[model samples]
Target: MEKPKEKPIIELKNVLKKYDDKTVLQNVNLVINKGEFVTLLGPSGSGKTTILRLIGGFEWTTRGEILFNGLDIKDLSPHMRDVSTIFQDYALFPHLSVENNIKYGLRLKRINLPRESIKPSIYKKQKNLQKKWAKEAKDAMKKLDKIQAEYEKELTKKKLPKNKLVKIQQWLDDSDFKYASWEVWPSLMNEKFEKKYLTRKITNDEMDKIVKDVIKLVNLEGHEKKSIDQLSGGQKQRVALARSIVIEPSLLLLDEPLSALDAKIREQMQQFLSDIQKKLGITFIFVTHDREEALRLSDKIAIMRDGVIEQYGTPKEIYDYPVNKWIANFIGDSNIFEGKIIDNDEEIISILDQKIKYWSKYKFGQNEVVDVLIRPEDIEIKKSKGLIKGIVETIVYQGSYYMIEVKHKQYKILVESASEFEIGQKVYLDWTITSMHLMTQEKEKNKNKDTVSLNLKLNKEEISNE
Candidate 1:
């Protein structure tokens, strides 16, 4: 049975962006499925950030549509759209404590309190319960506020342990106070509180619950009272993440959030972010120039170049079967061979005047020039009994393996091996025919050009004749 298609949470259709006659993005089309970690990957000037900003409503598209949850949201403002963004710099308020910083968005958020009709007797019972506990609840709140302020002051001097903070949070959890605030206690104790209460903003209790939950989610429990300046780069990033997620946005946009960190910290944060996204199950659209980073974190990657998406696919598909030479080279190291099909039946090909037999799923026309790519790791180095022989030009040690560059008559091949080889040594290179991947050339102005798909169809007919 076929699996059901996942719903698309965001879509960009023929999206174009320009700046004063300079086109930044051109005819971009993309679909991000719900809860998928999608990355927009490219070097600078590829307009990766422009696509992010357009979807975020920071910049309007020149021509096309942006959809969220199947509805067009091209004109919605950043705050109006149910989206949150974590910028490259951790945008936290230095003056505010970590907990306050996380609560910043929650404080500004407005939510309509739900109203429900109830029996008069039940309503009176609820009101009586509120009146009985009102004074004790107010006292509990005052004491909680005092303790929190004192904790913040203590954090400035020295960092406290997680157990100490947990004790304070435990007190709140154990209390019987369920009302939002003491100031609104009387309003909540009235009849309207049970029937048609219309408070439109998040109450203190709601804000505290949300902030606490997000802080715990990001593992920032003990550091919640520390000011922004007191934290490390990774901690600051976590604070920014907690702040954005506290409001529970439908989607999260991360714009190179880890670029500024040190190598070790960046790697650790990559795993941290991946774990967090999976835990929350939120659709994350991350942007980065690092190919390895994109490959590691993204469920789907869109590789952009010169204001257009050159290719978009899973990391394995893009790495193993790149659509063109540029993408193959940009993605990873590969040895490219430019050759022509010299014979059709025997699958003989000519590369640099040397005839070799190749195997491919798609058939090649006679004398047709094509590009073949073989990854460096796919080629094996042998002392004898191989398809081609070469002289080792350079050998570099890469901790776990050695990268050996070999020079043939007119081609330079790279081979990664566990065994070290000396320079100037003769080496035989061999690989299975199935390891070779044929690349499709970019289309030209001719509308009737034959592509790989057409060649595959023609090949199927020839096989039927046998």
Candidate 2:
């Protein structure tokens, strides 16, 4: 027999949501497939949350249809939609115990039946159910451990040639695992080590264990049972995630979930979220105002402005080939210059600046105003080795990277470098023509329009060697 075909869990068709006299969402169309995790990312007032609210049935769309599994759900109440939403703040009931708070959704279903007619307290049933799931999780963890050991043994079994072993040892050394000096690897190791170590640390029947296990896919283990008041901002956010995933919803919606966390925690959460999404294969829609987070977490991202999708594609496409200027700047730091395009060759472009020419894949007509976007990381920073020389204005350390701001010819541009360059020191900025992102010259003319593209003009062929 042929397998049954799966349908999209949520489909938004030409959705337009507007407040009186203001349109928050415009012709919004999206399809969320079953088990797919998608994120909606944009700045404040960009209508990220509006989409979430519409999906959740908290608000009605001015125009369009919302379908769930081929059935129109536009008029369904929030509770009728099988989807679940996780807010940044833990919206647990203060009067209820942790376990009860979690089962509130299930309890709400029971309210219609005679309260006394129910066979068992929801807590009692939930406890038993939790115990059953706990046992299953424990067994799964053990299986994971066995698999890991088998792999490790296989790695050790290869009585490799002396040189091969030496090479492997060098590789481990370079990875710093050899120097880690821990009895067991960090919880971040494969599922096997995690199961073996964490299982030993907590009871299988522990509610905390269930929460921890859900977050384990996100690389967060331990620290369960800690009150929300005692946790760090990031930890609290992860706790919220743990709580949400513990129930395993088929559709998960995250709206700027990590916005309040510190930078360190945010980075950790980013990786964790990616790992969890892959492991669960559940449909996840994340809404965020952070471009970097969107780029990092999304398989395909849609850039939204004023409730409309400006552009949508893979991160590389959005970053390397933005259709307009606002999108280019929104995705990453860019240096933009405006000048008329005087030459067009499929692989090269000439700007009217006379001093600057670029090599790119996109072509524009002569006299066409064009925009150029060059990422800070793409520009070469060095002493006495660039097309333009400028005095260092500022240097900021960003953990693994350094950002240097340089002023040249009254124009200040930021450049990223691994090695630190001193303030007041003269530095040259050199960028290859291939690094340029070219856009249509009509940006300025369309500037007054919502979502206008900016024009960037490049000057100088190459930095001279001193």
Instruction: Name the candidate that leads on TM-score.
Output: 1
Give me the runs in candidate 2 sitting further than 4 Å from their true place: 1-8, 75-80, 106-239, 346-361, 389-391, 441-466
Q: Relative to the unseen true structure, what is the C-alpha lDDT of residue 190 in candidate 2, on a scale of 0 to 100? A: 27
* Residue-level lDDT for 422 in candidate 1: 90
Q: Which stretches of candidate 1 lie over 4 Å from their true place?
A: 1-4, 75-80, 110-200, 344-346, 361-364, 442-466
lDDT (Cα, 0-100) at 428 in candidate 1:
95
In model 2, how many backbone clashes occur? 18
Per-residue CA lDDT of candidate 2, range 212-283, in tens?
Answer: 455564444554344455556776666566566665667778878888888887898888878877787767
Instruction: Give lDDT per model, in order.
Output: 0.83, 0.68
Question: What does candidate 1 score in Cα RMSD to the true structure?
Answer: 20.2
